[model samples]
Target: MRLFVGGLPPDITKRDVEGRFAPFGAVAGCDIVPSKGLGASPGECRGFAYVDFEPKDNASLARCLSL
Candidate 1:
């Protein structure tokens, strides 16, 4: 499953975000979308991210809904 996370701190890192969701399930991948605009670097956090979880017998869905 892919989760769209928003309202994150600007300084948060991709590893930081991945660690957060690690407890829920196996993280297939994580990517923090960089802010895009004048003065924004390519590596800047956009305050949003995409977290991909490896499906495990619907466990991911259950855990997420329980949150």
Candidate 2:
């Protein structure tokens, strides 16, 4: 199941996000995206992610938390 997540802390990583929703069920994967930038890269966080939860309940909860 796929879940969209937003509003995250700068130090937050894919694993961190993955763990947060893990309580719901098994986690297939979590994709944490970075923001657009140039040299030095700005290193800005996209503040969002796509999490794949194995169980339907987890996915549903993740979706709810995303919004």
Candidate 3:
């Protein structure tokens, strides 16, 4: 299952997000939206991200959390 995480800090990294959600379950994948501009680079979070959980039940648990 996939979860949409918003209101993230601009400096947030994929690793940071993974760590935060890891306790709930195994994270299948994570993707942070990058800023758009001439010099915009990857790793720069755009205040939101998409997190994928290995098991659908894990996602449900994550949703129950206050994160």
Each candidate: what lDDT?
0.85, 0.74, 0.84
For model 3, give the 10-residue run with minimal summed lDDT.
Answer: 57-66
Worst 10 residues of 2 by lDDT: 36-45
* Candidate 1: tens digits of C-alpha lDDT, residues 1-67: 8888999987899899989988888888998999989978768898999988887725756766688
C-alpha lDDT (0 to 100) for residue 19 of candidate 2: 84
Stretches of model 1 off by over 4 angstroms after superposition: none
As for model 3, its CA RMSD to the true structure in angstroms is 2.8
Off by over 4 Å in 2: 39-44, 55-67
Error of 2 at 15 (Å): 1.4
- Which is the winner by TM-score between candidate 1 and candidate 2? 1
Error of 1 at 56 (Å): 1.6
lDDT of 2 by residue, 1-67 (tens): 7878889865677778888977867788988878765632354557888888776576466566689
> Each prediction's TM-score against the native?
0.83, 0.69, 0.76
Q: In model 3, which residue pairs have backbone atoms overlapping below 3 Å?
A: none
* Model 3 bad stretches (over 4 Å): 38-42, 59-67
lDDT of 3: 0.84
Write the candidate numbers in order of decreasing lDDT.
Answer: 1, 3, 2
